[model samples]
Target: MLGRLNHVGIATPSIARSIETYKTLLGADVIGVPFDLPAQGVKVCFIDAPNTQIELIEPYDDASPIAGFLKKNPAGGQHHVCFEVPDIHAAVADMKAKGATILGEPRTGAHGTPIVFVHPRDMGGVLVELMETPQEGAH
Candidate 1:
């Protein structure tokens, strides 16, 4: 079942520029260190907010999915919204039973937790990521 809103993903051409914008414009101060996820093909960083975090994602290579997203929106923009789930497998099953189109199988995400993405068409025009709730101190 759905637990809580985890984070909002934003695709960016440059993580460093995005981080600077967040700091200078939003006064964001709790940004996490940026890291690369070669398997996921993204370089990511998190900016902690009052309620949830903001996930800044940049393509790690031309083949990255984010690279295609950026091509469509050169300036980059909101990519997806992630929600926490109590159980990823159960959630994926529930989505399937409801006729939702999932993009792929659950895999480890930037937060070091299992995650799966639901097709945008199945989620009211918004890409949805379901992430299994992280264990304490996991990330």
Candidate 2:
């Protein structure tokens, strides 16, 4: 079951540029250090907000899926919205039973917790990520 709205994922060509924009334009602070997730094929940075965080993602390589997203959206754009789930396995099962298309199996996400994405078509044309609630003080 869904727990809470977690973070919004934004695809970007350059994390540094995006970070600067967030700071200068949005007056955002408390940005997390950018790190590469080779397996996920993205370089990620988190910009903390009052309620949730903004996940800035840049393609790690040409083969990264984010690269494809960037090709369609050269300036990059909102990629997905993540929601916290009490249990990823249960959430996956529920989604399946509800006729929602799961993008892939649950895997570790930027928050260092199990996550799975639902197809955009199945989620009202918006990609949805379901992440298991992180343990206290993690992330």
Candidate 3:
């Protein structure tokens, strides 16, 4: 079972601009900017929310996943909802067993985090991401 909605990933061409917009318009507080996984080609800034988070995702490379997405939709917007899961592998397995379509195998995400994506069709047209909490002392 899922624990809680961890964060909502927002695709943005200019994270700096987006951060300012969120701060001025939505009063979102910048929690932190973490860079621990260059392999993922992402630079992330976490913004706190009442019950979730606004994760600004800026692709470090043109080939980054988010970059490809932005190519199709220039004005970046809400990308995905990441759900915190106690066990990502198990959660993915369960979702698969229940006929959910998976986008990719479980793998490391930004900040060296374990993550996976379930296809939109599986979650009623909303792309969903599953991530395990960073193991204590890992980050």
Candidate 4:
């Protein structure tokens, strides 16, 4: 059902500070350049880890969903966990059959891959993102 743990998303008030923490404290390498996804309304960056990556997400606007999260947390925290799936449509169906609450329709994510989210309540209060494997020479 799940391929692998793709990335762990960390909600942060500032990506620059998080990058420094990952570099200077965690001794991270291969830090990705931050990019803005206006559609998702967030600025994101990735820090490569041995087994998985750390996604640092910051709200792009006041209307950003992360902004709402930050309002409650103020210091930001673990936003979500993303896992890879071989076939997202099949995965979606499987989840639906099992009575999981799919958050929304499948959409192109930051990686330009088809992805969908499962509701937190159904996943024991952890937001889960299911991402389809990015194929070679494909979007």
- Per-residue lDDT of model 3, residues 1-139, tens digit only: 4477878899888888888898899887756774534577777887878766788888888778788889987889888998878888888888889998888788987646789988888788888988887777643
Per-prediction TM-score? 0.96, 0.97, 0.84, 0.94
Which candidate model has the greater lDDT, 2 or 3? 2
Q: lDDT winner between 3 and 4, please give it.
A: 4
> If ranked by lDDT, best first, what sequence of candidates would result?
1, 2, 4, 3
lDDT of each: 0.94, 0.93, 0.80, 0.90
Which residues of candidate 1, in runs, are more than 4 Å off? none
Candidates 2 and 4: which is better by lDDT? 2
In TM-score terms, candidate 4 sits at 0.94
Candidate 4 structure quality by residue, lDDT tens digits, 32-97: 999998888899998989878899999999989789889998888999999999888999999999
Candidate 4: which pairs clash?
none
lDDT of 1 by residue, 11-103 (tens): 999999999999999999999999999999999999999989999999999999899899999998999999999899999999899999988
lDDT of model 4, residue 130? 95
Model 2 agreement with the true structure over 1-139: per-residue lDDT tens digits:
3468889999999999999999999999999999999999999999999989999999999999899999999998999999998899998998899999998889899888999999999878999999999998886
- In order of listing, the candidates' clash counts read 0, 0, 0, 0
Cα distance off (Å), candidate 1, residue 113: 0.9
Candidate with top lDDT is: 1
